[model samples]
Target: MAAVVRGMFALEPAQHRAESCQPGGRGDASGGETQPVESGEIPRCLLVGPKGSGKTALLFQYGLSLVRQGRRVTFISHETLHTMPLHVAGATKPDPLSLKQLQILYLNTQEALLKFLSSIHTQAPLPTQAPLPTAILVDDLDYYVSTAQTAESAPVVARLCAYLVDAAYFISNKLSEDKTSVAGRILCPVVATVAPPGDRTALQWYERFLTSVWEVKGVAGQPTMYQLSDASSAERAPLVVTYEIGGTLRVLDVQDLNEPMEGDD
Candidate 1:
């Protein structure tokens, strides 16, 4: 079965690529490691921003890249699922070329989302024979938490966050135990999108679980800027990226900003 799965999603022999950022700039490496290091160097990350800040789009870009590399990507979303490409819906049976490699799961309510994370945590090993690495993308986590904000259910959200952190550790530890696993692959990293908390107290709650946080800032119809800060260091300079519908995505670094503007003398 492992062989069959391998055949279905052939691993590229080329060196695994890491997320790139300009010198002194920080870019979120939620989908995979940022450097050519071990599989579990950085396992969990949170994307925080206001609405219309393009957080979902950033996550989609990461997931799409993983899928293109023939890796397994599981996307769990409370919203924006309908806007995703049709292929991300996945296939019933394995197809080498199909988006079966990308599994999309939708959870509308907070309870369902909690249950899903709990299941992953309790399960010793994921039910998959494939050697391909897996990455989990959680979109609109704020929406999930908001839905269960009643006084009685408030604790559930905190537990949910803890479970997510546990899940990432469980997956990372498993991959780390297997030294032969591909570097910069195999370990599961949890990347979630979160809106700025309405209550200041909630800030510490998230900081407790997430290893890194990338704050996204931008307005609709404008380039989005990402400022990343991890447990290791203070926040770094932002990286600007622009995406157009039906057009290519462009990234602007510090050097790019120094270039002449359209109307510059």
Candidate 2:
């Protein structure tokens, strides 16, 4: 059976990506919406920002590149997804070429992620050639996590993240074990594009639960954007040198060259 995956991001949570909370509250990596890990370095990332922050656009560009490289990629987004030529054909349902190109899942319902993952896992394989390396992309993640009223939904979301972390570990270490399994050796890194929490409540929650966090702060006067660096950093990490879909670019972390901040908000 082909590997199945629950999407990490969906469009429903776009509105509530950033929410404020009281000073003392329970949120962060350990107890909140997090992406934990099993071990080893996996190429998983979380792109966070509010609506119109260009998350979906960036994903489309990235997905296309992976397709060109012969990587089996999947994109999960809700907005203007039909615009992506590689995802769909003339009408609804993915075309054979599109399916073989990369598995792109666009959804209107937030809960559809589970169903989608199930479908991927259980689907019949193509007889043409070897299966491509899979890269799962989730476009918007904050909507469901923020609106989850009961413990039920929260766990569902968390469990999905845990699954991703597990999948990454399994893929990275697939051949390392004494008894290698055919399953683990074929997977690729799972990349998710999430809207980072803009306010106290969301930010705290993300820091606690997510294994990796990368921030994008709009540059003051410059046309290009940059990434925030940890306090110990000696220089700017690097500017976004590569361009992706809808003109999205890589993160540039240039703390060392930039002026010091009076205080962070």
* Candidate 2 whole-model C-alpha lDDT, 0 to 1: 0.42
In candidate 1 the C-alpha lDDT for residue 103 amounts to 76
Q: What TM-score does each of the candidates earn? A: 0.61, 0.53
Worst 10 residues of 2 by lDDT: 1-10
Tens digit of lDDT per residue, candidate 1, span 1-265? 1111111122221113332221101234456553332333545567777765556656665565556655567788875466443221121223456466777788888788778766664554335644323677788877777676575434655677777766655565555444454443344667788887766567556656654565555535445433322221335323333323223223332222434778889
Candidate 1: how many backbone clashes? 0
Model number with the top TM-score: 1
The lDDT of each candidate is 0.52, 0.42
Candidate 1: where is the Cα deviation over 4 Å? 1-42, 85-98, 121-133, 152-157, 178-185, 219-265
- Worst lDDT 10-window in candidate 1: 1-10
